[model samples]
Target: MSEDPDLFSAISSQNQTLSTISPERLTSDQATFELERLATLIRHYDRLYHDQDSPAISDGEYDALVLRNRLIEQNFPNLTRPDSPSKRIGTRATSRLPKIAHSIAMLSLDNGFSDKDVGDFLDRIRRFLRLGAQEPVALTVEPKIDGLSCSLRYEKGRLTQAVTRGDGIIGEDVTPNVRVINDIPETLAGSTWPEVVEIRGEVYMTKAAFSDLNQRQSEENGKLFANPRNAAAGSLRQLDPNITARRSLRFLAHGWGEISDFPADTQYGMMQAIKSYGLPVSDLLLCCHSLDEMLQHYHKIEAHRADMDFDIDGVVYKIDRLDWQSRLGFSARAPRFALAHKFPAEKAQTTLLDIDIQVGRTGVLTPVAKLEAVTVGGVVVTSATLHNADEIKRLAVRPGDRVLIQRAGDVIPQIVENLTPEVNREDWHFPSTCPVCHSLAKREEGESAWRCTGGLICPAQRVERLRHFVSRTAFDIEGLGLTHIESFFADKLIVTPADIFRLHKRRDTLINREGWAEVSVNNLLAAIENRRVISLDRFLYALGIRHIGVVTARDFARQYHEWDAFSKMIGQLKSMRNILLPSLIETEEKYRKRVAKELTGFVNIPNIGNKIIQSLIAFFSESHNQSVVDDLLLEIEVKSVHFQQQSSPLAGEVIVFTGSLETLSREEAKRQAETLGAKVAASVSRKTSFVVCGKAAGSKLSKAEALSIPVIDEMKWQKIVKNNGHISVKTE
Candidate 1:
């Protein structure tokens, strides 16, 4: 974890070896060990960057770790650990607010860091739909706001619930907090609105607001948040709604979630509808028909990012047509039809004053660089993370050496490179022991980070884990803030997560404690009691496993459906790992095959991989982790996931559209096709049941003719889509 020279050398050498070594050169044990180490390191970094919002590495450096992990996994799929960082999305929902399950999951978008990446994303859509290169794919481009995501559910045109995008599937209810934001409409303007609709958008603080808020915090001796995104999240997640109301929080609608009925069929049209309903929508939204136009819009947005009142990290490009969106479907974590193209990282040069090692809640040691003050992207950079020993060695940075610092998407600053390295100095070495507790800190084989052997005994780790346990996606007990958790932990009033459920037993003592008023204590107890009957997903997420995030936890919940069943299966897997079958009962080859077969089932779970399977098996294999699960199960009920599938007429049919329609727009035509129980594809393929060719039908028409697929004109298409003879068409 030291930013010292010796650690850097170790990392540099290790990375070089990894890069040069072929998959065939590695033994099964070597690959397995490397995969485990990479998984651990990546998971630790993911938590630091995503959950805590205090990233210790640059995006490029992080991407390298992910790339390394991926390469290893690709080479040795069977060696992949169950807890591999690749299987998860953003960090677990670890906030203080109560968790609310989203009616429709609010997924993240895959990133397109370059023009080629964006082009590939579009090309992917084309390939998935069997579309020709020349076919037009209308896309809606908008600024990807670098702010907190919020989902606003409106019933009868009145805003009822507002939730943060905690983990996509579930979020923390912030209805009261958001109700006071001026940008959000209290009621829709139109009478002809859906019975239920969830408007999804970003909750942000203007640059002015962020500056003003930070100034006030400094004056009041309050903790200053890192950036506008952090400040906005803190303000919106305030326990007291009045506090949130006082903050200058703004919201801008971009998309939606669950709806009783959609007002429009295209993304642009939907945005217009949302704006007409009195919701604030971004004026930067543009509809682009070609990849060049999308890239142009992206560059324009990037140029304006610094000038805008609010912060934006990138430009989002989504398939314009709703029917296309539905047909394109989604990946485990993101929509396949949408992408986020991030702005380039901004860099500046500064002297490296010193290197500091900081240990996180999970015991992973991180190296930070103390830098001479330098301006970067309008902010004065004093310090940046070295990431690990390897990053330091990679840059060959030393005290007094000039180094390049980068800030991208307003994320944590990182030392990108060393500008000066000729000055002679002794090599710095990372400590072999934990600085705080004097516990043995060891870097496992093939790992980048050094971790303290101390578990619950380490105060920092203990406090952090407890905080995560009560986070919004976990137990979500109100009033048990980090401050309270620290105080309770220090006093030995609580230790393990199970102790949270037993807090009511400490009522008499807690009531008499300092800063514990009767009303507050009662409310805290009530919050605890309210969450006694929790869902299986939340319960699993509360455990703070290395890589079991909200989405993965939901996957587990859905797959197993019940606590007893999951626990039993995990136990069986654990037994299988520990026991060795006799050759008489079953041949060694057969036993190995059986083990692989069982693991494949776990790995095949959508989004679940060998890394996660290994992590799960390793966790269950441990007596203490199992005990924690057993104890937690005794304290609460784990509800099963009940899926209610909606039936649609376009359930199985795949239809394609070509040319311009006279009566309906391309998007509307696709929507009508979907409404009539058809999947509107981008091109005519063997799977296509019918192709609607309108005026000036192009390559698709020819392809459909060649394939002998049924081809119909606009009038015939309208006749087939109408439910009861006449079609209801909206004029442009």
Candidate 2:
């Protein structure tokens, strides 16, 4: 939780660090602290697999810790972090039931395990649409499921809400436990749909209904689960909707979120119009087209994923047009026209039986191993990832070794060998401090992790950053949880996140404490004064910087829309790196690439790269984290970003269109060239700033007339979006 300055360039001057080991390519600074220690061990296994359905590594070691925190934030993009587990998505709803907020950010998908990761997902959608290598594309595929995503919504067609993808921007109002599931429908059947939509999918549970709900929770001793996607997310988050109408939960659909119109125009005509509106989709969906029919429908849905009864783990694909997924948009979080693929990690062996460690909430440590219970694909394996102390000295693993492992989808398992590594059995060690505050745990130099200098007196990093500043994507206070933040931080009655908004000045000392009452301390002080107004991008992701998340705190609250211009742009990049550090402290790596080229010359927001501007200049250069963000800005009120800034004049054009038709419809001419901030490209290069053409045009209108570009035609691109996208185009 430190490493701010000296943005390292030494590790014995490179040439060997690249690890994840089997797969190794990250370049330097000891593999960027193994991508910030696999983003603090995949955010503590995405809070034990999406908020405690209990998973401690496996689905290919949580996809190799989100592909090594997405290849060290794609090759050192400013050592990315700010609580990153690759910009989290699924895991929130700290449940007691009701919570909803997602008018569309339920994302997560971007895997591919092999078949050349599906021929590099069709050569990255033909190089982001400038298509070529015999341009075919198409897609659709399906399968992926392994449940609990949800969504629903609809509107004039009925069934109004449903939620649960939680951390993808709130969720958990399981619309009365998805109204007794009967495969979800309550309406939309024959009403030409689209009066409003939403739809998304998965909810699942079926290996014989998770073995008859774990044989009725093992004859009512209750708590059983561990699979069928954690018994369909603990029976669709039940705070009792008739115990999720007796847990027979199921659903399918696949895609969609926040609609209003799009009844068709493609992702296979909107999942055949969301499968003609009766709900449930994926009868193994299909459509595909070349890269060997999407690897023969992902090996026929991984050879019928064990004779299917819900639980799939990989196939997905998507990209069956929809204006080429709005010109292949989105990447910081997912959906560059979808991909998934997965399935390949199911080996077995077992026995290790010991190694523990744990300690994360940012004190680092990790380790884990355990083992012996052994099952793998049928989900039983007791534990896996040992990712540090340099992978236990590259697996000289001890405690009765016998390893092997590997695994898929069941929460990313791993290990890959050490089957009694030459049975000598005695050298194991590792500890050297802070296994929970013995502190001074160090590690450094070519770091493979050992952290915990006990910052803020590590009671596990102050009760996990005050349970991630009241988590559900930060500052979502509501009934303040994580066991009332560790019973109000062990009776000191709350410590930070501005003392839970100064618990109404200890309203009668949390109503005379002890599981407090008086209407749960006035509903946790009206959910901490309904989050005292929040929103400058969840108050800069509830101030827990370090490679910042929530998409770089909405790209620095949409580029400084307030908190006094985002703390005056991190106090003018820390007073221009403290007025050039003592004469550029002997070429401090050329002033850290000249302060990431002065944050790409005035950071125009797009995941504010350069390692999130060196984690917002190392978190406002810490005067006690700027006095806990100025004591959480004197108990909250941040709210100030509203730039729906969409100027136009085809804001930096690059279109292409080709042999289209009369008026619009090449999907509204590429959604009117992406609502006029153009770039509809699918060919015609020379950074093509034009080339519309309608009547039998062809060869991208002779490659936009051999790259001269500007061509137009469909009535001069509908008179440049009827004069709104601005005029001044002469070539007819």
Candidate 3:
């Protein structure tokens, strides 16, 4: 028995014809040979650029080879194949994501860093296909945006869904958030339109916007983003679409994912088709008929990368002919189709000047290193997160140590490796007490953290708790912003949860407050009134109790079935404390020793976990804490769970999306689905039952096909609801 030689025979046949072509019209064999040659050349360059982050030749030179191959293939169209080098965009996405085979396989391009590299590439094609020097190599060059890669799908001339370039095989569906971008049209306008089209490009935040966003984060004591690329990635990956919508992000389509009945024979023509579809495409795309012309364009882009509004790592070159692209096959990861010639790392070295500690809402102390100004990837780096006391000690970094800081993933600036010599120095001891409140700080055994035990009594902790309680994730209390909370705290109108109830009584005082206008006071008061009654889960979460998170609170509410049961357990712990072993009462200079002994006993309760019990016992044992809890309970009433016992459509199901969608905003849609009982997830696999697809539905759609998941559409969804009796049929 012999191995199947179909693929090898195919390549050998193409190679024979590729060896003979000159300037005259190509025979069918020459066209096929040229296409395969382009694929092989492009795949090699793709690895050189994407994986090694190096290029052997200028992008323009590589583009010329692709263009030449494309021209030949145009004359011989029947030889086109699916894995061609001319049809795709961008590298296959990272493997950490669920794999998504593209709706269309993204291809790679050949590269040429010098005339030699360019000449060699052509020589191989010429020798393989029997071509001569008179046959000119042609190419196209374009800027490669450095940001999150994604695809947008349109159906029936309407913008429907967007997906990240997850693993080249599958991507997380993120249509809802992408829809909010003003630059991303909701509907493709034109009577004559492609039935389905997938536009692929990078989602980028402009440098100016990144700076402004980081500045705002800095002023508000929020986590400062490392760079625009990271900011864009983080913002788009958010589970909440509202966050994405508020970031003022933008999108530009560079190529297509899936095109139906596309009337294009070349890459240049395809770009024109994409633009005509009402999508934003770059105006700087250049067509070069010679390798030298392509190289010229590549140099021009490299010289002007920083001046552009968006960040670009390198230049992208593509083969122009659609037929040639098909003939060119693929490799395992990136396409054998296109290449991205990356610029050298924008990494520079600088000295560590000072280390600063900041307290977060969670009471975790973060250590930051102030750095001497240095340029990293075209952005100025002045500071980086040292992470914690342990991290600093591990590096033995002190003030004035020269450090090599690399922006991790070109986003967060981190001390990659200490470049300075270690000197005999004092150990950077973790703080023993909260810096702001002077309360004891303790690092729990086996945990990589030191936290302030001051809890809510610490003003920093207090302000943070107040902020969390009002944030969109928790109670979503309108009008109770940071300014209002700070003002109320200063005016003594609010100290604990109970003070919120008494705010109305101080209307005159609030109106007369320093920063409050009449309208402000009224609005604040009205917001409080509206939130007087809240859902059991939300109200429980708003308590800001130690060790009690939203998930834990929901669990407790479900188990205990009422706030009284939950509160009664807390009260019982207090009662038990009064009867503690006399040995535990020996509070001396060695207070932690005494506490640790008692902490062991606190963890013995069946349902009371160690973390919860520790936080509860700590809070209750502290002087004036019981009163705060008592006052809060007196001020507000927590509503009982109303819908827990009711039957719901999505009550226990876990759902995830992997493709583009069209029907509703993803955010509102997710919430609607969740409200009905579905648990929305980010990836797709065997666990997924239904996959809703829109235009350009990528690898996940295929995965759904593989897994035999029921794939449906917006109309099918309506019918499902109607059949399930979740919706009523209305008379037209």
Candidate 4:
């Protein structure tokens, strides 16, 4: 059987470079030979781990091989091939289950947050179907179980094998371990059954099992698992089935993937049919007639979250009609017919025992709420983040106030809402002094949060700043984590951002430091050395400047191609504030316009606002801040980015847009193509193919391409979406 075109298409479009690679042209004989050998080895490993669930090599060793291949491919881009095994997510396919490639890629479902988000999903479905408000519909609402996703295959009315959901299409065979599951029947009740049925569900650990596992770990003096979700992931990922069999893993059939035939025409019917085959389907599952009913069902599930035997992160609602499900289809990574509504995390009520302020890496003082011990979401909660002093005042939460705490998706717990008594109020005031350096705290104009006057000298901020510098989103300095950064800060081996660049010079000093060994220090230094040339956007953000997030940094980089230009602009802004004070108070419009003109030269990129401008001014005005910049400049060199204009097949085309593109969202489609060396204009012009229409595609499609841009639908757009990050379409 041939590999599904949709699967390969998505893979190729996602990784255009990989699909286009030719082994013959990669190198002069010797290099090509090695590349082929390495590729073969990597693919074999992928199959071994992904398909068989048995890995011969450790993760570290595997990463080393992949990194080597990446380096080789980077240097010899011409020789690189798209089909290289390095692109696979998990273990490769095994021989079990007849290795049936999916007809449709078993895409994961997209997660939604609040009721509004769920409403939006329903709206999309309604618009897609051109349905009226009175139109009848039904939804299959099931618990979004937190577990290892696995695909179970049944053929000739018998349970054939089980496969791990590896990269959606291909999966690791966990047949041996799956066979032990008593609830999973070996044969169907009735003789008549589909030729093939791939049952998809989550394999999880119950609350009881999770508690026992943690207790055992505690008794052995081993590290306690953070949560049940992580515990389940760790257990299922074991290379040996014996290890898996020992773990009290439970499976719950939530849905089906590939089905040759079924007596039911709706999803709920098929689910019932599967349950008749003696599979363990939870009774909590509900069938709702409308979005409102679905939400109501979700609320009931959320109320009983703590009491549930198994852990569930959210509720999954699928279109009940199978025909509609097929028509609604899926995007590359997720389905369009269904959505997961995540519950507002379980909130624990606790007393605000104390309040403390901690200095961030950027010298921002964040207030921490020390709470009396309480359990939230099955995890013990003791503290929550207040965010800032304003939040504390807003909540009116004092030392004795009872607060509700919530944790989501393994993030830090936060005080969700205040339960402070108005009559017995103890109003908390914002601190005037910096907690770390004892410097005067001041809130810059147009900004709400107070910041420490001290810049890099603030000890608390140093470790955070250093961590941010090495973070994947920032400089991406490998081998440097929070522990290494904290250690270096305590030893005074690194204090400022500049120290990171200079640490390589004192290799012996770092190596000889307490708790520091030869190999670890060397690896850290190597990571630092590799990050010699920082990107413009990352450098801007790594400066720990206020009001600068990823998008802001990217905009700053786009506007000012050179670091010198940006630095000069910062200096000029500082000078202008002092020199042009009289001119600033003219008229609101005049003042804003004049300031904007000067600002545009330095910051005319998208999304730059008044709040950001104020922070930039405050940063440049401080002499200490200037000193840090000078110190950093001496040790670190900012690499100049040469923006090249590349010709793309979709470039310079006026693409007409319409509808809700299921594959790539409208904004995402525009952003993707624009990023991929293509010009994304506001409206369709003469040179547009690619109407790229979605459901309810509007007027633009009718407006003929004045310049000849070809219009395409979501399906065709999906063909180009995969390999190219910018080609990604947004699904609501």
Give the per-residue lDDT of model 4 (tens digit) for 1-732.
223222222222211111112222222222232343355556656565544444555432344345445555555443354444444444434443334455445566665667998999898887666567889889899888977778788998888877777767766566777776655677876765688887888888888898999898899897576566556655666667686676688889988877888769988888888888777887988889987798899999998988998888778999999888876665445677898887664567889998877665555565777889997645566666676666677788888887887664212466777786588544788899997779889986654457787666777666656765665546766666566667778878778777888897889887787777999888878877888788787788666666565556666777787899888878777676566443534987787676766665455454576557767887777787777778888866787665555656554444556777665446556656665556555556554545677787566766644444466677767666555534433322
Candidate 1, residues 1-732, lDDT tens digits: the string is 112222222223233222223344343333543454455556566556545656655454565466556666666654455556555555566667788898888887766667998888887777666577798999999998878889999999999999888757777889999999999988989887889989999999999999999899999999887788878888888889999998899998989999999889999999998898889988899999998899888988887777999888788999999998987776556787898887776688878898877665556766777888997655676777666777777778778888888763112466767788466677667778877677999987776767888866778677767866775546766667667877898889888878888999999989999987898789889988998888887788777665566666777887788888888877776776667455678988688677766675644455575556667887677677778777877888888875443354445567888887666567556655655555667767787877778778889998888998877777776665654323332211
Give me the candidate number with maximum TM-score: 4
Q: Over 4 Å off in model 1, which ranges?
A: 1-113, 125-345, 444-447, 581-596, 599-609, 639-641, 646-732
Candidate-wise lDDT, in order: 0.73, 0.72, 0.62, 0.66
Off by more than 4 A, model 2: 1-111, 114-350, 361-367, 370-383, 386-404, 407-455, 459-626, 630-725, 728-732
TM-scores, all candidates, are 0.53, 0.28, 0.46, 0.67
Model 2 lDDT tens row, 278-382: 887888788877888889878978987888777787888888888878767765577778888888877889788788776555456667778888776556867
Query: For residue 720, what is the lDDT in candidate 1?
Result: 59
Shift in Å, residue 65, candidate 3: 40
lDDT of 3 by residue, 408-525 (tens): 3211366866788766877566677888898888876665556787777788778666765665435655667666676678767788777887889998988887777899788877
> How many clashing residue pairs are found in candidate 2?
19
Residue 615, model 1: Cα distance from true site in angstroms = 2.5
* lDDT (C-alpha) at residue 484 in model 1: 82
Q: What is the lDDT of residue 510 in candidate 1?
A: 95
lDDT of 3: 0.62
What CA RMSD would you report for each candidate?
13.2, 26.4, 22.4, 12.9
